[model samples]
Target: MSQQTKSDYVDDVDVDDDWDDHPTDDELEATVENLEASGFDVEVVSDAEEALDVLVSEIPAGASVMNGHSTTLEEIGFDDYLGEGDHDWENLAADIWSIDDDAERDAARRAAQTADYFLGSVNGIAQDGTLVAADLSGSRVGAYPFAAQNLLLVAGVNKVVEDVEAARERLHEFAYAFENERAQEAYGVESYPSKELVYRQEGTEGRTTVVLVEETLGY
Candidate 1:
């Protein structure tokens, strides 16, 4: 069977700028506080550097860390940051089921299973504190269930959509395109059809802790 391109599989989802009526910082703070009250550990940071500090401190020394293929992580220079830290960190970039190498592929799979902490982004998080995400490669989203002991979701304020429908739209409109671009750049393909897998799963990870950053972080 012939495979489809990303453009062929992804539905047209639009981002409504009207939804950009963001709350004030105080309101955002209160919302975050309420989420914490609901038993979800939440933190808000000003920028990527502070996020790195939080990441360093949250991940204990000697703990194994697994990372998703987060554009935000790459944008924030997490690869370099991980090198400077003393903890054991594994990059799951090659685990997306698209990589052709066997050993690197196996290592990525193992990293997803054995890591103490997993870090990535959410497609959308409701103002009421519900976390929403879509999975394409499955590895990035699949790892959430049994891959890591603790799941840390780092999302930008822009990712906060009004509802799940909006979240899905954002994924098709923004996240999917961004992710596809990265895939093309790395793999020399214009698109990958695996994106249809996104509709197969709900949220990833069992125990999830979300960190909402006010500024733009990841794609």
Candidate 2:
């Protein structure tokens, strides 16, 4: 399947004009430095394809993989790749969704958080190295903070904010409206920022990697 592009739904929602601008080179450099100092490995990619390539190459064969719902992931083709593309890793998302029993499926989701690799995207990333993310459910941000063995977050440069407070503001004032429209269009329901996560630092070294793409993507 072809990857879903931002152009499909971007025009349908009201995105904050302030949130759409990419960071300056100096800003990007500072963000990267702070992220690395906070114990996350940083990867800067020129485009979505390179971001997808880096994401794919980070995990080894036979590793168990799971991901939360992320428009950014879909934009970069990771969702389709993990679901239908040729890959050697154990795709836990596929397995969990195939279950017939609701109870079992819910249990699988909780357990899958500890998969060898957990991938998703954040709503806002502070220049000071803080990451802000929220979801209608805790499915995505839940795995980001120590639940997963390894975390891989992919985001556009537009997500970078001035500080943690601004990151949080961006989540509600900027990302939520766009995400709400997306939820309505795709699932026939509205989305809310029900659960939030503010990631300041990683205690374990090399456990998380943030891939920042040059192009704007997702909410």
Best by TM-score: 2
lDDT per residue, candidate 1, 94-148, as tens digits?
2336678888777667656646788777666555555556555566666665557
* lDDT by residue (tens digit), candidate 2, 20-102: 78889999999999999999999999999999999999999999999998889998989989988489999999999899999
Report clash pairs, candidate 2. Answer: none
TM-score of each prediction: 0.72, 0.94
Candidate 1 wrongly placed segments (more than 4 Å): 1-23, 30-34, 84-104, 107-111, 190-207
Screening candidate 1 with a backbone cut-off below 3 angstroms (N, C-alpha, C), the clashing residue pairs are 144-205
lDDT of 2 at 25: 98
Cα-based lDDT at residue 77, candidate 1: 58
- Superposed Cα deviation of residue 115, candidate 2 (Å): 0.8
The global Cα lDDT (0 to 1) of model 1 is: 0.60
Q: After superposing candidate 2, which stretches have Cα over 4 Å from the reference?
A: 1-6
In candidate 1, where is summed lDDT lowest over 10 consecutive residues?
193-202
